[model samples]
Target: MTSTPLHKGIHPVLEQDHPYIFIDACMQAWPDADYAHAHRHGVTAYAVTAFHPWAGLDEALEGLMFWHLSARRHSHLGIAWIAEDIRHAKREGRAVFVLASQGGDFISNALHRIEAFYRLGLRMLIPAYSRTNAICGGCLDRADGGLTSFGELVVAECNRVGLLLDCSHVGKRSSLEIIERSAAPVVFSHSNPKRLVDNPRNIDDEQILACAARGGVIGLAPWGPLVMKPGSRTRPTLDDFVEHIDYVAQLTGSADHIGIGTDMSLGTYPDHEHDPWGEPAYAAVTREYDQHVTADVRSPLRAVEGFSSYPEVLNLVDRLQRRGYGEADVRKILGENMLRVFEQVWR
Candidate 1:
């Protein structure tokens, strides 16, 4: 006899139906991937990151345009500019890929470039990534120095253009300042809690509280390092990932603020010579530092066990329910919470 799956009764419509919205808060679209894969995952929408920290304006456009052209060529893909686009994509059995920029450097101090990309379907942006830049300090920066004067301007511009502000790779101090400054609620687009995993890029209790206080959302990523403890080579389980959801719920007093940022980054650098390790910022990131550092982002670059891709996202609902999350809260954690933010922020 076969045992009943845990999620069957918990989320009856999850595996078979697509009535409710399901989104991947973070999806990578590199030139190397060279195709739209979100459609195959059964996800209703994705916020696609087609950029890197060291990429300049020219390189940034190339990445974004690569997807833009693919979406045009592919019948299954569409660029989501607003919440309606996502809804429509769901109705049409399609997946909408929203263009995103992970680093602020591509704008190169040209504030209007923010809106320019916005017009081209960029709905989200993280002003800094891993290291300090003209806009703000990053999580891996030697000294946070907090948000800069220019960073404040960037926040206002993002708000003005209705770009959803993200603090995933931003420094703690800078992230806090950004959350406080933005008229719109900012997001930790794809970060986990520091207390759970101790990664430098993860958010802390203070950041979580600050974000939740302002009606922001904390999007947890399924990256192995973020889910499992550092220095552990053991395969991370779904339980390990769900513990984070439980911790956030207990800490914030609600699951209203929790969401997924699977960080489903796929593809390689094409070859070793083209690897990002050649960059100065990435070099410092690999260096053993007392304050801000990374623990080999290339160690298999895998997701936690039982959650290898978007199709497996619903497993969280069952895990969460068994862990005692109510149906409404589990829905919020899966996708509703982020969609709520989208309706409020995006034009």
Candidate 2:
């Protein structure tokens, strides 16, 4: 029996790397599943933020939401009201805090609130999630409309304040409009190329190209849905993940426009649970729904097949050595592309 080879080329020089990663954003459901442990991975930098249930006007609750993150060094915990704590964390060499919202709902239809959040170190905003709200429509929405008037205002203000606007969950039309409206380069923080998996959540080839044309970076996620073929009975393998990355690189014609987000949900939430905020966790919606679970969504084993951690992922450079992606290209996919987007949009 032959073992699988995870890498083929020279291993990446992670020691020289800042080891920085923007997890795109995630919910706090299970710590072991969703949160990245720097000590475990030897990751030097991370910008961690919540994914949903916009932090409301309650400052105390918001503080509590982010307070736990302060204990971790080299993490950027995100929340709406933890500005002071985030600043302090950054100074302490903990995690640099970055306030992020999954939807514009954090401001509740008020674009002015963006300025307030920006003042508080809000670095990124997702115009929509699976559902549309006041500012813009989402991909799952039936209307398929573009950004609303307020959405445009928010985009402009995000630009003015030097915030990175993430179009990952926005509707196809809205994402296109946002690229046109943003004054700064935008990001598709944790998306994959639809050409590979045909997911509505993934960006289309044209969308990928448009984003790259505006100096934006699209971070590819290493999750079940992104790499799986529709109706296929197969768990995502390293080759599948690389295929999506390769497709995006081809779509953009440069590895510099793509980066890895991984989107690994290690310990955040139970795979079978779904609920908003403090609401009760919902069980699998229906018995029929149980049958919908695809092979790709199977609970990931510790190492996720070939790679267990970021360092393991670096081994990909070795695997693709003869695939025409050189060391520089590998570095770009691992972090440089994201850094370029960060420097451009987080000004």
Candidate 3:
């Protein structure tokens, strides 16, 4: 007798026809992969990291333009400026693209650029990345100075333009301050919980509660060290990834505040050297940090068995089912939670 498929009678959330909304909270646009490959991944939406603190204003603009041009080149891609755009992309069987700035450096200290970038289809902004900026302290900064006057101004501008504020790479004090300051819900678009793994890039219990208190959702990142115990020789399993989700759920007493933001890039950092915006561009951004410090900043080089790519999201869903997560909760974790925040903040 032939065996039935594993997902054949699984929870509806694990079904391919369940109208799944897989959104990667953070990812880099690789020159080689392009939008064509991105559309084929079965992900409904992606928040592409078009700008970061390390890039100069001009380079940031270039990166934004590259995404714009790619969207124009690919018929299956459209910029998701609002929640409706995401719904429309799903309806049209295409991938919704949302540009995100990983740092305020994209504005070059100019406040007016917020609206301009919004018009250009940037839906999310992280006030700081890994170092101190005029607006706020970065996670790796020497001091957690919190949000500066200019940073408050940026938060206000982002709120005014309906841009979703992200606190992923921001320092603890600054992240909390931004959450408290913003009228809209804030997101740690691609961050893990520090309670699970003690890393600068991870958010703490207080931070997680603050974000949930503001009705924000924390997108669990799948970067190696963040997912697994620090310095573990073994790769993180799908269960390790879910533990972050479960921690946030149990901590917040609701799965509504948690979602996936696996910060997977097209390829490793070294592979981008041949691209137009390659090592030189990234190097300029990390010049202040010691060489050793900047070298290990990329996502974990090792691939987890079932948590490798977008399609592996199904694996996550299956694992969630095995873990006894209800279908509604699974749906929320898969995408509804993030979409709810998007609808609220992107208005």
Clash pairs, model 1 backbone:
none
lDDT of 3 by residue, 180-261 (tens): 9999999898888887777667889999999999999999977665666654556667788888988999999989898888
lDDT of each: 0.76, 0.59, 0.76
Looking at model 1, residue 273 earns an lDDT score of: 44
lDDT of 1 by residue, 1-347 (tens): 12322321111123354445777788665444524444655578878787665689998888778777878888988888888888888888787887778888998879999898888788889888888999898888778898888888999999999999999999999999999999998889889988988878788999999999999999998777677666665667888999888899899998989988887644432222455566554423222321222343433335677676555666776688788877788778878899889988998
lDDT at position 84, candidate 1 = 85
Task: Order the numbered candidates by TM-score, best leading.
Answer: 1, 3, 2
Candidate 2 residue-wise lDDT, 38-96, digit = tens: 32332323344444444454642364355245434224433323334433433443433
